[model samples]
Target: MAEAVAAGRAASRGVPGRSASGRSRHARILAALVALSALVYAASSLLRLRAFQASTYDLVIFDQALRSYSRFGAPVAMVKGVHNGFGPDFSVLGDHFSPILAVLAPLYWLHDGPETLLVAQAVLFALAAVPVWRYAARRFGPVSAHLVAGAYALSWPIAEALAFDFHEVAFVPLLSALLVERYDAGRRVQAALAAAGLLMVKEDMGLLLVGFGFFLLARRGERRAGAAYAAAGIAATWASSRVLISLFGGDNDYYWAYGSLGDGMADAAVRVLTHPWILPGAVGSPPVKLLTMALLVVPLLLLPLRSPLALAALPLLAERMLADRFPNWWEPGYHYNAFIVAILVMAAVDGAYRLRGRRPPAALTRLRPVAALRRSRPVAALRRMRPWRALRRHLPAAALLAGAVVTVPFFAFGDLADPGLYRPDGRDRAAGAAVAAVPDGALVETANNLGPALSARTRVLLWDREPRGAPWVVADIGRHTFPFTTLEEQRHRVARLINEGYRPVFRQAGYIVLTRESAAPR
Candidate 1:
């Protein structure tokens, strides 16, 4: 008995239990995978940079924030004093704080401009791949992990979302990572915290959180935890609504005309139910249409047989289907659902591989005759081990390559249409020239195009306010309109400025810059 025990110990030690050499090799493989992921992300980032042209809307919004940050240490509510507000009032709690702006504060401090902030956003987006990979790896093995990360990093929707400098959209990946992490750990508290953080990151994330919460509660049978989540979600929704209403000064412009929550619910239901075809429209093409449908239905078909991953994917699918009230179907910014789609695809691929038969490729059957002869001895044993070893060593690399091939094309060739809100005309150039010609600290009144540009250089009156040193006023052209001035109004405003001792020193496509006339002193 003692000899047998000694033999067992010796066998255990000789069996190479989790060898350091093997571990070192695994670490190297993981490192290579991570490095490859970074390379792909870097390539995607470079591509995005090339593809991205600063849109007029982004410039207008970013310039407003930058000007506010530079002058008042806060984002200006309006360009000119009329209807100046912060935050999206239409969505619950949509406009309380500009999350991206707050995060970009450091970047602003480094080099205060929209270009700097855009770069910062791109960098944050790239970094999101790490957590995404971790989430995939934990559930589906390192192979699926690398694939999911690469797919997410290069996704078209994420690339397009960068155009708007939108704060709400960035939360998709961040919140997804947190949800995946907490769900994997089976920690209710951490999950709740993640949910709350997601909601705080953006109001739309609340829909994601609610869907995920119900999914978790249903799957895990955690009644108390689920109840807590439901309660918190309700409270957050209410609080966000109240805060938004107050911020917008009871203006219901952002909200639908439904007078109450019940009416809003009815409206939301009508929007979704009546517009079933919006799903295909949202995806924008037949291929994407097919892909989107496959993504939703495929995993669900697998749910009865495989629960964990399907559970994770269900919330994402539900969020996309339920939140259909967005303004445009093809609007690239609304493509936040791509993150969900990517995750679900990865889950489906993982399930497929997991369900695959544990057998050698059929091509090996040609060698079956030789193997039959070899099976009379030890040679067949070696042949059986070879396939397993090959699979173990190369699976992750193969999966990564396959995922890249499937998903990279979307980002590489996605359509970007112009939204025609800004002009490339000589207006900006003229405005810049006018500001440059103005005397330092000159009191100036300029159009919208000129105001933000001049705000940094001099005290510009936006809406015909009395010039205090460097005071910028958004000119109130009656009924709270500024640059949307009719031809008649534009002529009147220009004439009035001239009569008030302002001289046009520079003219651009859409704006005229005027400095206080030398004849008039403060």
Candidate 2:
């Protein structure tokens, strides 16, 4: 009988069987760590809000869309519409199929501020660590699971993307993590819900699901499920291309990321199907592809590669590497990582489970370089030293701790690779107060940072735009360094505003609030 095991078993961390309480204790610890992650992310949110670090471009666009949804209307993005030449009320929903933002509409009714969105983003990113904890704990043991969760909570990509600004991609990590966990556990219903949730996030998720379906086919051998997922992805891609975005978004297709392949998405698709070798050549060169993988895997100690799950990242990797327009996508730091990071970490945790409590192979110790070192009397004596046994026993824990340390910088700024963005002096109180005075529904042209605050209150055009009889204009003349480099260039627009029948209403700290001479305060 090959060793009859106990009906209920016990092992420490990754040692396998454990009593119920031990598992609960591990979960509680991991939860506490996730809370810590939330606190850290919240602090970043606060800094961004108070310091004027947040931008109106993305924030205002999202808030407008969410508010429109709250009002039970099509998500016509007033802000994005103006700048992209899409008119004052174009459907942002067409641009990206994120009905998921509607879920946040109720929350907007409660607090109705851009800060609400920021904190929500922080919480979502923090919660993503849950699946990481669950997967890692089950595979590696609770202790190592906590380590993986902590490292995941601090993963560079999450921090950078969150810190950069609120994006629809905020939901990606959580959804992807759920998809992996439920799928691995054979919870088909939950897995399908999670997979469907991805399409609701953004159009790109359709392709991602197709790739993941293949991963499922290859790994799970569930041909029906895999084919269904792929079919759904293909359907979404076709719908988005032919109808969805075209109906709601700008007049032209905006998928310029693949501009290198052809004129637009249609041409790009043709090129991809007809010319198979185009993928390898357009991976931004082999060296870049190698570096992109290294940056992603190195922070986790290259453990994710042990699992076939890494194959799921291929569609995203291909999408990015193939995009000649978005060089930023070729790197690990930005919002691009939001889509790819979860599964890689899941793979790492799963890999760690296989690694836990195992000794280094005799083959590893017997490698030529190791054997040569062992032949040295000093090295051999060191290997025979007192602490060697202890080192062997705790080596896995040490590795987890070390990798966690390596990824610490990312935790500092809500995204690891972009630390220089942390300018703590971000709040402009006087400017905020002036912005608060603007009435809701009034047309106002405002600075980038100020736009998020005033989004719900008024129609905000980018500051530099010619007011075109807009009733108000707000400019922080001295606050010229962020959101864009064109703020100083807008100084000329101030003269233009005065020339075009606008009068200054308030001025302090380079923040000048203006209204049309016809509509100026009596």
lDDT of 1 by residue, 82-191 (tens): 32333222212234433445555555567654445455445445545555555555555544455556555555556555533433445456556656555555665776
How many residue pairs clash in each candidate at the backbone level?
14, 15
Total colliding residue pairs, candidate 2:
15
lDDT of 2: 0.72
In candidate 2, position 470 carries an lDDT of 67
Which candidate comes out best when scored by lDDT?
A: 2
Off by over 4 Å in 1: 1-52, 59-75, 80-104, 187-189, 221-223, 244-263, 266-326, 329-335, 338-522
TM-score of each: 0.59, 0.84
lDDT per residue, candidate 2, 270-317, as tens digits?
Answer: 988999787777874646766877778887778777766776777777
- Highest TM-score: which candidate? 2
Candidate 2 segments exceeding 4 Å error: 1-16, 249-252, 273-277, 285-292, 331-333, 352-369, 372-401, 410-430, 433-441, 479-488, 517-522
**Candidate 1, backbone clash total:** 14
